[model samples]
Target chain A: MDTTVVNTGAEEKTWGGGNKPLNASYGKMMMWFFIVSDALTFSGFLAAYGFSRFKFIDYWPIADEVFTHVPFVHGNYPMIYVAFMTFILIMSSVTMVLAVDAGHHMNKAKVTLYMFLTIIGGLIFVGSQAWEWATFIKGDFGAVETRGGNILQFVDAEGKRVALSDFVVAGEHERVEHESKNGLWFVDEGTLPTYTMQEVITGFESHPDLAIRTQTINEQGHKTVLSREESIKQLKANGIGIVEGANLRHNEYGTPLFADFFFFITGFHGFHVFSGVVINIIIFFNVILGTYERRGSYEMVEKVGLYWHFVDLVWVFVFTFFYLV
Target chain B: MAHAHKLEILRGLIKFKSNTQKIWGVLILLSIITAVEVVLGIYKPESLMAHVLGMKALNWIFIILTIVKAYYITWDFMHMRDEKASLRRMVVWTAIFLIAYLLFILLQEGDYIESVYSSGFVKKDF
Candidate 1:
């Protein structure tokens, strides 16, 4: 096989196939194509989210209220932890670009250091996302699901949120959870909520200061709180079950769709971050072993850096649409 | 191959001494923009709550700032700016146009369904 390009007369034409029209290597161009397709995939998911949100535009769950937990501090601090996560991802992106820059200069030491930092940053971000998911699943103030599937939360006279434990008194009724082993072979039930509907209703009747806050948002952008009389009427007549946390079937937050989108989008993005970290580890070892040094080019590092930065880019959009917007 | 980077951002208004310096500079700019977004989200001023172009002015600000951040991340971190002009357009323009079209169709359909739910036989509350 002839290994050299023959000097064909067609080589001088603009339509010649021998030239690099895009001025990019094959690997880099393929990476760009992959990124573009992946971006469209993410855009599809985000647009679906926006559609759901717009459908429930009047009563969509407020992001600040839903994501108000910090790891150690107890008070309501919304958006702080998510902001921290965003900063970590952005800073890691900076380090990744620095790694690629060092690779350009052929400084093996700097590339190794920056790659290590980028991996650490990726780990921290993924861990934080896991923690966030856990916190979201374990809700704070429990709400009652009405027969109409509307969520009814408890609030004090001043409209401050009140936890079920603060007011609900457990009754003496014997309750048992159903299991596949104990119940019929094919039958089972989910975990029982901490407070039953009877307990919540009784508790509401006993506390005159408590009010019912519906999922509907008023013109003031706040949940509509009913008067004490209306609160009692709504609870006794409509309250069917207590929703303690979030799941695919039900959410103590406004709508179940909100929880579904939250899990799917963030879960997918977290999976990407996890894979990015794994790839960075592989590349980090290759850098240490001087694989690129022997190859006489650090283009592999540049390729992986493109992927790492793309992950960061997607997170920027995720952070905006989910948390900030 | 030694590659030369265009060492400026914001249409040459902000220049850096080197590629590494540019990376840090873009990082700072992104951080500041994120900070501003968080602050505005937390406070949610009354004046900004007024409707503008069928959405809240505050929300418009957020969306615009988000696009700005996306631009810097793509151009600087992903080295899209250094790519050939044809490749840049093929990647960036493709995503942008498709996303815009998708959002328009989906949101319009969503709004239409919402109106049906509000006024049509499908009752919102049982």
Candidate 2:
């Protein structure tokens, strides 16, 4: 008596177990879910960055000033190189979508070509990021860290940045960097900076055209540049250590927090790009071997394309928040 | 299966012949937006520097343009528009709501901390 089946047609409903309510395959839907969660992770990082930046609004380092170097050409070309990197990543996203479109059409040759191009574009972008990081670590102009944990840069009378090597005269005093072999058995000091505090102060005293630029931003939206007399006084009173480039512990640009966020956010994003490239390469070989072609659907390419485009999307935000805003 | 794409962007103001064409169209749009952002960032016009809603107008523009670019990348490149409405809302709405809420709370707290640092009796020298 209980064996009779009901004709309610539950399977025909959108929410029924057999129906694809989202009009997407299980694998595709899972990819989307992963992307959604990944997006949240990235937003968390960016939001934390914003919080730190807002906390130090008055002395936050300007993005334009921090990223000013080009590959070959130099001389204060701010935002140029980063703009180039953005374009490269966007162009690669285009190639990725095109690969997906070709996959939809089951066009093996086009997918291969476009996937190759996308991989190349990703490589170029990752290489550029590495170059940018190298340049940032190898700073051009050096500065001094005050006793109060603030940065003090140098500028000329015209308010142009001056490198420490330009005027710092080496002194006769000899000092050795602490090493594990010589100093405390377990404690070791970091690499010594190029110039000493005394050397910088002496050089700055002789150059009347030079000035001290503090990390504080004035009402005019620039670093507060002290006069010659004030520069001497501040350097003598507060200058405690020399800081030449950027590291996790210190930064010549401004607060150490700026470099920390820059490395963390961009480093995380760069790792994403790298893994995307590896995935693209794997799919590239699969396409070459006709794996998807034999499966009667190139959906594998589409899934990977979704991942690739997600990477590009994250870069767009990183570019805006880190570079533009 | 061949998927049909909604071959138009900008609320159908621009139409493309095919999905491939649409991809190129969105790329161009993204590029133009990026270029505009870079230009504004470089110049930082005195007019736009004025605070509009507790932020520089220029920064507001950059954030808005960035959202526009993100929309196209998701809608066009990721084929969000071709998917069913249920899927679309599931992905976009969730991320948007969560990120907005997080940003608001964090930024407000950060501003409060800044005020404390500037005005409170806590000694900064230490």
Q: Pick by lDDT: which candidate is best?
A: 2
| Model 1 lDDT per residue over B73-109, tens place | 9999999899999999999999999999999999999
DockQ of 2: 0.77
Model 2, B64-116: lDDT tens digits are 99999999999999999999999999999999999999999999998988888
Question: Compared with the true structure, what per-residue lDDT tens digits does model 1 show for residues A239-314?
Answer: 8999988988899987999999999999999999999999999999999999998898899988988888888889
Clashing pairs in model 2? none
lDDT for each of the candidates? 0.91, 0.91
> In order, what are the TM-scores of chain A for the candidates?
0.93, 0.93
Interface RMSD of 2: 1.3
Which stretches in model 2 have alpha-carbon errors above 4 Å?
A: A1-18, A177-183, B123-126
Please compute DockQ, using alpha carbons, for every candidate against the native two-chain complex.
0.83, 0.77
